[model samples]
Target: MDTIEWQDFERVELRVGTIISAEPNVKARKPAYVLQVDLGEFGVKTSSAQITAHYSAESLVGKQVLCVCNFAAKSIAGVRSEVLVTGVYDDENRVVLASFEHPLPNGSRLA
Candidate 1:
């Protein structure tokens, strides 16, 4: 494993955001969703996530998720992905979203 200074870790903008909307990403070769996240002061951002194995568009709405907010925007499939919705792969190799049980304000930095 590699170690990093606290400052280096702090530089990563890990924030919580609510899923405002989600829909299938038709252009993606693999099944995926195009999500619109409400990031409070940071505004709404878009991301393409391959979480179909454990999530559905209807189930994701109103869910609060962790996001890597500082990464540069990139085109994923046909969507212009902005923030990176954080998650871990399960034993089945399916993505399980990093989520919060209690509601947190959108754009709240992870500390």
Candidate 2:
């Protein structure tokens, strides 16, 4: 991987957000969900996550997950994805969310 300076890393706005709501994104070719995340000061943002393999809509609500907030919005599966919900892949190639065990204020920045 290419090494980046501290400033470069700082440019990526990695923050914690709470999932306010989630639902299936029917327009996606692959199974996915449209999520509404509360980013506190950043307000609520939307994301399209391909996490249906490991999580359901009911399981995602109220979950606190990390996200990249500065990314430009893009159209995904007929929805506007405003932020990138971060996750790591499991051995089964399913996405496991990067979440917190305890509650945090919405839009908490990751240092």
Candidate 3:
């Protein structure tokens, strides 16, 4: 794996956000959800996430998740994805979200 300097890691805007809303991204070719996350000072940002294999829209609301917040927005399946909701691939190649164990203030940086 490539090694990154501490500064490089710090440049990444890893922040906490709560899922205010989640719904099916019907425009997506593969199954996906359109999420609206409240990031405190950052306000609400949208993300198009392919996590339906393990999560449901009802199960995702109010969930606290880590996000890569600074990447430029990309258009995905008709939605403008703002932040990237972080997750890892499971053994079956389905995305399992990175979540906090306790409630955190929205927009808190990951240190």
Which residue pairs collide in model 3, if any? Answer: none
TM-score per candidate: 0.99, 0.97, 0.99
lDDT of 1: 0.97
Residue lDDT tens for model 1, 5-62: 9999999999999999999999999999999999999999999999999998999999
Clashing pairs in 2: none
lDDT (0 to 1) per candidate: 0.97, 0.96, 0.98
Give me candidate 1's TM-score against the actual structure.
Answer: 0.99
Q: How many backbone clashes does candidate 3 have?
A: 0
For model 2, residues 1-111, the per-residue Cα lDDT tens digits are 899999998899999999999999999999999999999999999999999988889999999999999999999979999999999999999999999989999989998
Q: Is candidate 2 or candidate 3 better by lDDT?
A: 3
Lowest summed lDDT across 10 adjacent residues in model 1 is found at: 48-57
Instruction: Per model, state how many residue pairs clash.
Output: 0, 0, 0
> Lowest lDDT 10-mer window, candidate 3?
99-108
